[model samples]
Target chain A: MLEEVVSGGGSLIIIDDINCCGRSLLKCFLAAAAHKGDSIHILNFDIPKDELRAGMDSEVAERLVFHDGFMDPLNWNGEAVLPASPFTLKELRVCIGADASPVTLVLDSLSWILLHNPVSAVCHTFQHFQRQAKSTGLNVRQIIGLLHGDLHKPAVVDSVCCLASTVVTVTQAPSSEAQGTAVVLQRRKSRKIVRATEYFTILEHFALKSLGQHQPLMKLAGEKEETPAAETDPAANLTFNLRLSEEERRAKERVLLPYHLSAEVKSSLLQSHAGVAKIYYEPDAADDVDEEDPDDDLDV
Target chain B: MFAAGGSMASSSFRRKVGGGLAVIPGTRASVHNGQLLVSTGASSLDSVIGGGLAVGTLLLIEEDKYNMYSNLLLKYFIAEGVVSGHDLFVASAEEDPSSILQELPAPLLDDFHKNNLDKEEKTTGDLQKSMKIAWRYQNLPKLEVTPAARSRFGHHYDLSKAMSSEMLQAVRCHTFFLPTECGSAICCSMGHAYTLLLQSIHRVIQQEGFDGSCPQKKHKNILRIVLQSLGSVLWGDDICCSDHPQYIHSLTRFLHALRGLLRMSLSACVISLPAHLIQNKAILSRVRNLSDTVVGLESFIGSARETNALYKDYHGLFHVYQCPRLNSLLCDVSGTKDLAFKLQRKQFTIEIVIHVELQGVLRNCLHLPPDLSDRASRSSKQDLSECSKVLNAGCAAMTAGRTHLDF
Candidate 1:
């Protein structure tokens, strides 16, 4: 199952790169929560809000609170672009005013936040939400952030992973656009860690259906092994010859050697001779045959 | 006859687009994801890169050893921009941008179809008239070319002829040439040509109304940006000079900012990086990661494959390292990985290698190790290079379910 493991307290990080899509998984989480009737506060940076609303149910779309960080992000147009800038989160509390329906905080893309600010500042932003959640009348049930894995340094990604309760890395499945693999790592209260890599398909409406452990990556090698063995001609695609030609076979038949016994020669020799055969035995020096014993010297 | 074909193409172009939004003259929406696409001046190349190049995206071309074919591709791109009436931005360090724009290959009259369209129509009519038994075949509706393909989104170019001066001056042009006249040193990152290039492009996008947030002009059009030999020694970049160049990060950082500019503007970029000369494979992969679509050209001029009988018909190998996955779960990849390019006198065609039916390709060509010196970079590029080797071994077992459409 592509389980929705929303931690009871902390956030979940969805890591993706240019090769795969993490937004689909993020939307799946949002859709699941909205069905349960919880408020979703999304900091929209990557894509427009209409795109997010496209595949979602009408009732679910109503629960989304969009903070416009995409249009006039740098305040370039000089018109009023509400909900504050991406680099600052001081207005986040004012934007989430009077809503206490157990909010699920979603950063549409944390990379955009990181590009303008330092790593330490971003870590502090996560900490500020966790420590100050209850006092501000905002019941932050879950915090989910989507990070582009390749854009940042490995150390930066690892440092962010340390702070999150769950981290999900996504990669595109081989030879498929609709299929992908999700490697999920979750840390529990008892310091126990759980990890799993599951293949999944984005069905119609992007309902993520898990394909379980059946991976196309492993299936490719297995198919390659079976085809060569089933071919009737064993030497079809080999680098060297496995069978000899007719001339080579005939040449092998003509060659003769000392003490090389053929089946035909053995049968002819046995039929030609009909004399009585005598039994003889040879003794080794190590056998300790006594010269005085007459029975020992006789051959029968 | 060509005029008749051109009229048919333009009329069809007008029919489908009546949404009240001004349709750009030479662009169309991608069927897969609805992203706007502009052609790269080569029909065969447009097919290979999963339809034409999308707007507000970067297309990276890894230059061959001699930088021959990559230069031609840049010309094709710029020529397409001029033909389509889009604004042009050409930046190069090796040659003057004006000269690069001046020598673009001539487009074949107005029609893109091979030979004469009228002659082909006459032959088809003759065949239908001669075959009296199959009278019903003439009444069947045609399905050879789709209505979308007939829109002339792309065109054929005669490579042997240069575009006329009248065509070159038909559109707006922006040029950037590195200033080395005063014996100003072209050091690694000090001259700051990349910074200057980025600044000028940013200025043009904002001033010329290419940027989405700030559209200054009533007529909205695309700006085709071409950066030739970007990371080579010519571009005052040092990523190619040593294993650890002083400004190794400069190129990648520039690409990141350039892409950011692209995302908000009606602009598309084509950069030809001399990847083979770059000492660090890590740097090359980073450059590839930053770009949206990456395709490499491997010329066979000095390679052993040039003398081989099996590859005699082709000039070089074409490797598509990456395709952009924009606003979708997966990128649209060309299924067949083994592709070759032939530079005919009149045209250039990047086709699925025709020798796929010849079974065992020249054993020597298959066994030769690729020219890549990659180490410590498991970026999966070497895996792409190894795909053809595995194919020529008579077991295309890896690419099992891929569609190989014979054109």
Candidate 2:
């Protein structure tokens, strides 16, 4: 599902919080997009381009056109540093070009742009770029973004999520190469929302392998608790006696409720025939009964 | 716990780079992976950080309180640069770069052997002192000790003596004293001290031909950058002044830019940061994340751990917080975590605690139960020193040219 949403992309917002990084997960999408043969234009502000391309394949890496917002983002180093494009929509489309069908614009991070530009403006630019490209004869299909969720206000993250067609939240999961658990939420063409979560490992070639759906932790705990405590008694830890001593359990049988029928009565009651039922009544001391019929005097 | 995490398959590996390795001064190719590596001045630290700091990477030193040992480490780095004939770029906010340069510990130019190491002692006394230190490792197989102790890349510096003026004069040194570079007035704009510092480092890398992008006709030499106590009030950065400074990510951004510049250059840097003083750990974590390698020093000064019996032999503890994963999926983690560093008269060394070492040795000898060995490892440093003394006695007896049985 993560792969499907990644490849069938419109605008993807990867929300990563503290303790789990989202870059590797973003790489999984980049790899997926590249596998689909979409030219990826990255607006990199977070990390350097080489560090960006560190684990990626040379062939796929070649397909990534980088506009550097990191190296000299503020023109802080001026022309002495490498020529870099500032974060802008015009530069983005100009790089994507009019002829390239299905070009994917990847924001190495939208949070960096959010910090610089107004929250509304950044989201508006991304949303407008999608619609503006269609009318301009541009085949731009996806605008995938990496957002560090913890860095921004909840309102900012909410706004970013509101605009994105797909939001994949990457969090730490150790079973996989510590890659993380991805909870992908997508809005489909039918106007229905779809959400699925799976523990995923981004395998060597940036291949995504789902470790199946995430089992609710409470259910797993419940399963542990539900297993018979016969092997290791749950009563073992109590300071007070809560166990059945064989002798005491037998003694417990001797002491019964007042309403509990005697063994003979219980046996006789159970033995009654199915069709022609027999009343095997055993009277208690409190019972009152009249043997002679009052109607006998009236009959005479 | 490398988590290699259990060895990646051959098919998973990308094609290896094609070339002969370039020989850089004070550097060697890592045996684990074939990336170029340079020393951070402490060889044991280099080993703990998986061979050495790969060139074009940043090594951040989280300074201990009072900034004594981290400062020494920075000096050790400069001294090694001087010895190796590599160029130096030293930056400090609190002190003059030249004054800091003068105080660098002198390098002990002798061979790895203990010969001529104890110059003041008589030959007989030297023999006994050497025997005592040598016998400490006698229980372990000699093979496990020698090769690691004898790495040839970096030099050891004697903390007692300062480098001669003549030696300091010979090396090319660049200075970035913040007080002189940026006046006493703190910048109201974006971190000007930080910007100036970055700009200076950038200028040095570019003009000095450390930048790989611009090929230089001149011969290449590694520039060893020593940044002292950044984020302190003197650096005109306020990350330390208030809990929520106006610019929370100022120092981190500088480090990030520095790292970005480092990746494309032929230089490696060692920065000493007063991380203990940072009020917010999240900001500190961001700083740690920005740097490629981070090692923290916890000096046993006023801390309660100083009075603890377990750490008697060592002066302080050393932590390998993070090591860069170079060219491999997994990081090169050290075999053991119970590591401590000792600053002896001769040099500084980081090693596994003596108790842990004895646990392995005692397990081999007596085949002790797990609990017994645990108790033995927890025994005070005095007991282990006594054990080493007995081994020294045995070694002394064997040295007397008499028939003796060796373990």
For every candidate, what share of the true interface contacts is present?
0.00, 0.00
By summed lDDT, which 10 consecutive residues of candidate 2 chain B come out lowest? B398-407
The global C-alpha lDDT for each of the candidates, from Candidate 1 onward, is: 0.73, 0.72
Over the true interface, candidate 1 deviates by an RMSD, in Å, of 34.9
Please, what are the lDDT tens digits per residue for candidate 1 over residues B298-351?
A: 988646566545577898899999999999979999878878898877777897
TM-score of model 2 (first chain only) = 0.68
Model 1, runs deviating above 4 Å? A1-300, B1-20, B111-115, B120-131, B134-151, B180-191, B356-407
Provide the lDDT at B255 for model 1.
96
| A77: Cα error in model 2, Å | 48
In model 2, which runs have C-alpha deviations exceeding 4 angstroms?
A1-300, B1-22, B110-152, B184-190, B356-367, B370-407
Estimated TM-score per prediction? Answer: 0.48, 0.45
The DockQ of each candidate is 0.01, 0.00
Error of 2 at A43 (Å): 55
